[model samples]
Target: MSEQEHWDRETDLLVIGGGAAGMATALVAALEGLRPLLVEKTDQVGGTMSTSAGTVWIPGNRQSRDAGYGDTEAAAAAYMDALIGALDHTGIRAAYLRTGPQAIDYLRQRSEVRFVPSGKHPDYRDMPGAAVSGRALAPEMFDGRRLGRDFERIRPPIPEFLVLGGMMAGKDDIPRLINRFQSVGNFVYAGRLFLRYLTDRLRYSRGTRVVMGNALAARLFYSLRQQNVPVLFETTVQSLVRRGGAVAGAVLRTGDGQTLRVRATRGVVIATGGYGHNAGLRARFMPRPTPELSVACTSNTGDGIELGLAEGGTVAPDTQGPGAFWTPVSVTRRADGSRGVFPHLSLDRAKPGLIAVNSAGRRFVNEAHSYHDFVEGMYASHREVPTMPAHLICEAGFVRRYGLGHVYPGTTDLGPAERAGYLVTAPTLARLAERIQVPVEALQATVARYNDMARQGRDLDFGKGDTELNRFNGDPTQQPNPCLRPIEQGPFVALAVWPAEIATSTGLQTNADGQVLATDGTPIAGLYAAGNDMASIMMGTYPGPGTTLGPALTFGYRVAMHAAGRPVDAATGNGGQP
Candidate 1:
């Protein structure tokens, strides 16, 4: 058969991966009159996004203006300038800032993806341009029932994030659930959430009322279904099709053993979720003593980066932090033998009555730092102290009030976690230190010193509740320093945590328009990249909430626009040399 005869399918655009970026690309392509096909390696859509908080950081968004923040695009740019010291990606950074709000607006009008400004959600940093609430948009709860049978294709949220085994709950729900017994209104709200979940469980695998990243992904999936977009789940792109020295299409391998060749008239876009699960790439890119854990989907094994390299593409170098995005994670063995990697985001770490200590039982970081910065602290502390597997010390009251890592608040019974060796408990501080293999005397002194400072409403050592961001995430009900409280009650509990990546900063080099760039620092025609597959616009520095997803969706939209012969900015981005 001839070359054209071997083409099993043909399309205007071939998109790899079904994460937020890939899904948006296909959707926008269709809207722009380009026939696009999206192929996901897993049986479901939503890569890491489905398991995330799904907050999109788009400054100057309509919701922000309506909410009275009225942040300007210039102010956002100034914030980025103040936050990121390196100017390595100035061109793309400008593009992201310029187009991010537009992308959000585009999706709001054309797709089922709806977002509401999260009330009082502050930026991770209190930078000059950072607003207290308007910039961060939380996904609106999406009713999975809208997708019908295709609802099953939407990946469920992290098993641990669910309430009552199948019900989805937001960060707002947790505080209410914790205070449910204290208020009739809170009790009614909690009861209604449970009731809705129970009703949905009668017919669905999980509650159809999805929020966060699950809702965001589900909304995208529903929107695509509405447009009749062809989404090939359980399929992956094995290799890129090169024609006339440019990426034209790909060889797709289905979940079954079948291989099919697909040719694209416009080009191919790679958004394969980056190298989080790729052993070789992890070894090559991650820091020394490479962490063996990641919370991202297993299907994200650097397929896009590898494919891009075959066409002379280079992996963009990150000047700050590690190539991978950092998060302090606790490992838990599930009932099915698979282990759960739980990233300690805004929950337990920042709440009062908890202290994270190195192996020597000495306090290190503020603990209220952002998850990325928290892991960075772990690495820095580990250089002198064994900060790896640092233990978070708390008490019964602490867990009851705020919970630890995967442990839920108001959890009276710690039997399951204790029996599984996931949590260590002791009636006294010395005993708990002994149980966790930390110096007993050192641990006792640490707790005593901490209690003294906490009683004064101060973290003398690390200044835990100093930053606006820290106070925002801390327990608001607490007096004085919300992130500072004595951990004096027994039986004290301990949960071990280690640094792990939730995503990657390093990826295939791509221009502002999302076209994958060759080693010569020129755009390779018929090729584009987005999501974690594209080098981060932040240049490896995380500035605020939804840092990853905001740019992922923005650049994804830009890619689709460029693919459809409509570049968001007429000027091609500099796409800085590697």
Candidate 2:
């Protein structure tokens, strides 16, 4: 243990983790005239955010209003009430609703972080409180070149999510690239993107024009750099230092194996990503038959939660949903020997000719449902049979047009994937079922039923393409039901997928001000939490896109304002400026 006498450095605010929440905290604190120090366990800063779509689910934000979508705090509250009863988590939800828009306003006005409404992206569920559109917002494309050499410090997107070796394609870019050969406009678009990517490779290690979460992370990083905030990568908090019943500082361990005590006059904020990768914590907090796959950052091992717990912070109780955000992910080993966990968010599952089946070869879920609901369906199916690893079955035409998992569309070669056992391929549905170890007759029956439904453009059993969300991810060019297509082609393919977590919902309990609270429902003075370190305001139910990030940014803003002694707006729950 290092001696307290050897104090190395000090700051007014110490922010742990380098994701959206942590960076937001540090950035907001700095804007409030506080000297803040940010430390990251990994060499990079983005954490799991780099791998995401970078959508923030803040209802009634300026983006939505400006885009002519009429939404209100009351309306959003109504939706929340419908989704997860009105009485549950009323305070947290109210805090989020009030502060979220203000947080967006602050970031857009003061920092490089800019967001726009995600056009027509609907809420995850079609319940009473759901909005048809205009709730989710996504970060605009950011030029990573603005960060100069620091751009390298931004964690790149997941390898499987990229296209053409290292180039990142945004949501719009996907259709352009997939249809490049079909239309002149798409060809030009694809050509421009590839040419830019090729030119970028000549100088930078990766493309400089980034989108999605990479854009969001890079924008925040650029903001931090502009603010002169000291971000120390490869450094992590070992433990919190308590003095007179309050958190005073932290003992940090550097990448070089040196320990240093750093004191914070204002407070220390724990934004450490989450416990998604911590086996012990997962076994304890997560549901039984815990998922082996995690789409979160590798460094997210519940370090912040553990540190908070050491200081007497308590975890939020499990309620209606799983303690973590769930997704179905397919795993593949890259040529470099690294395992790639490809989260099935919106790429293929809902794209016309695909169906996810259990070991009994029965379709158990609405394939076009949101990723969270899809995994929930997986768990529900698991209760009935061995569905821990469900198989995503698709036909050759589907694979050729829409792709499966990391295997991109129009890929000329299936030999490598087949040899690597990532994909099970067969000429017939029965043979494919045999290859994947599912019952042949059951698979045949399931496909027959699915085919009959597809022809009529109706999914009677599961309602696959009924919702706006389902249609959004479906093939728009398809007739009748965009998500309904028969799998009559030969060479059927099956990829095994398992339930995976993106972020933990149950975490250190915090108040509306982001103050870390003890089990007795009292604040632990000078201790704060944001991001996954703070218990989710949604109470484990994912309402829409950006649910994790919206509250994270809002609470992060609240925490900084409270710590800096800035004037918080009573009506809006934000600080200083409106």
- Displacement of the residue 319 alpha carbon in candidate 1, Å: 2.9
Error (Å) of candidate 1 at residue 393 is: 0.9
**What TM value does model 2 have?**
0.96
Model 2 spans > 4 angstroms off: 1-6, 88-90, 567-574
Clashes of 2: 1
What is the alpha-carbon lDDT of model 1 when measured against the actual structure?
Answer: 0.87
Best by TM-score: 2
Q: How much is 327 displaced in model 2, in angstroms?
A: 0.8
lDDT (tens digit, per residue) of candidate 2 on 318-348: 6525889999998889879988888989889
lDDT of 2: 0.89
Query: What digit string (tens of lDDT, one per residue) describes model 1 on residues 1-578?
Result: 78799799999999999999999999888888889999999999999999999998888888878878678888888888888853744388887877887888888887788899886777777778777777889999888888888888988887778777788888778879879889999999999988888888888998999889999999999988888889888887888888888788899999888999999999999999999999998888888778988988888999988988887888856453588778999988776878887889988899888889999999999899989888888988999988899999989788877788788888898888899878999999999999999999999999999999999999989999988889998988888999999988799999999889989888888888888888788999899999998888776677888988998899988898888877787555311101
Scored by lDDT, the top model is 2
How many pairs collide in each candidate, listed in order?
0, 1
